[model samples]
Target: MTTRTPQELAVPVRGGDLAVTRWPGEGPAVIALHGITGNSLSFGAVAEQLGDIDLYAPDLRGRAHSAGLPAPYGIPAHVEDVLTVLDHLGLRQALLLGHSLGAFTTAVAAARHPDRFPRVVLVDGGLGFPIPGGADIDEVIESVIGPAMRRLRTTFPDADAYRALFREHPAFTAHWGPHIQAYVDRDLTGEPPEIRSSCVLDAIRADGAGPIGDPETLAAIHRPEVRGTMLWAERGVMNEPQGLYDEGRLAAGDLSPDRITTRRVDDTNHYTILFAKDATAAIAEAVRTELKEM
Candidate 1:
């Protein structure tokens, strides 16, 4: 399969607009969704690893290119935005792949619009994280990754700097390659100065950390028509033992196997799972195998 460069797009959604990127090809369409703060570029490696098809990756309303989305960015709203993109593409059904925050949206979309997609892949997200009886989700996310989240405010002087920074991140070091470089290329814009990145901090937090998660939301995800599979990083911030320093992710709670067939990929962390060669191969093979069954 040949990998193509990403093209910019703007699609209308309920709250405002969705910033989208497409890699055109001939075959069944596949909609790839990014996590919090991530844009269409997030799916670069997965798209390359998968079949030759029309790929659609959208930056949800509140993040990346579509940073002006209104408040209260919840699951329902995210599902609606996905629907809007499908409608805009004139596709009644397609494969759905979502990561982190995107996974939550994917589950909600498949649940709400059972006929809209035939297969949905959850990339280590959307599970109901353990929450105290009355604790605040936003506060929790902020406290856990405060420094990293705050760094979102600092824009890179150039793509090289951004790439170098990402390379240094424990998540991207081993995974940085052509696909990642291509993905980061889309975020560059400027005159001769060449400013880097299009992500917005407030928008990401508003959308990802806002709605949080509850049993009701998790239970609400039940899409029989949409074949479901979840891919998780074996060793990462999201799947570690609970403790004072731990992020309190995997330790939160276990998921019902009946809903999603989960798989653990070795030698990958949350961020690298979508890009690393071995990790991408695992995800692609799983998706292909599931689609064939469907």
Candidate 2:
């Protein structure tokens, strides 16, 4: 399949302009939301393989170019942003896909606004576990994503220096390429000798407490009006043997397979499931299959 350069645009919202990336395609429009710390380019590799639809992903507020956008930054804020994008584009309804925290965001959005985002494609993160009784939310979140939080605070001298840092990340060690490289580049901001991540510290903190197995999220998957497809990876962010949702966990979590469909992409970790060679191809094909039915 042939790939094309994506176009970037800024959609005005309440706090600031939301940065959006559009990958031209011939099929139905797809609106994708990235992970907590991820920007729109997180879907670049998937877009390369997916050529049948117009794919759009946003640099969610407090991330990448939208980093300048002010507070009110949680799942609700993100849901509002998603709706604004839909309204700005004049889309009554479209395919809604989300990865990582984005998966939860889409779930909440589908549950709250079924009229706008009825179709859902979830990647490796829609399921949320309840925090143990009396657990500290900040501590729990930090434990879950400590390294990323540290990376957000650390400063790099330049782009290559930052790249070297991520190159050492366990998740990308096996197969690092342009997709990973671009993801790294997009995360870096500020001038040389003092470059830092574009993701806002506060936003990450706020959203970390946002969604996970909440009532709204659960409703998104079980609701009759929403059609949901969940894709699971074989490994996790650290390329661990057990992924975020192993078979047992998935079976336990998904009580209603009738409303929500689940599938696995083998030889892929949570991060690679979106961009790695074979993984991306599988994702693209699954998307094509879904669009065909629609």
Number of the top lDDT candidate: 2
lDDT of 1 by residue, 230-257 (tens): 7877655432332211224444444455
TM-score of each: 0.82, 0.95
Consecutive 10-residue window with the lowest summed lDDT within model 1: 238-247
The residue-by-residue lDDT of candidate 2 on 1-294, one tens digit each, is: 567689998999987799999997777889999998999989999998887689999999999989999998988899999999999989888878899889888888888887888678889987887765666666777676547888888999988999987788888887788878988898889999999999998898778776542556545556676677889999977888888888899877764777777889899998889888898887777777666656
Q: After superposition, how far is residue 78 of candidate 1 from its true place, in Å?
A: 1.7
Error of 2 at 86 (Å): 1.0
Clashing pairs in 2: 27-52
C-alpha lDDT of all candidate models, in order: 0.68, 0.84
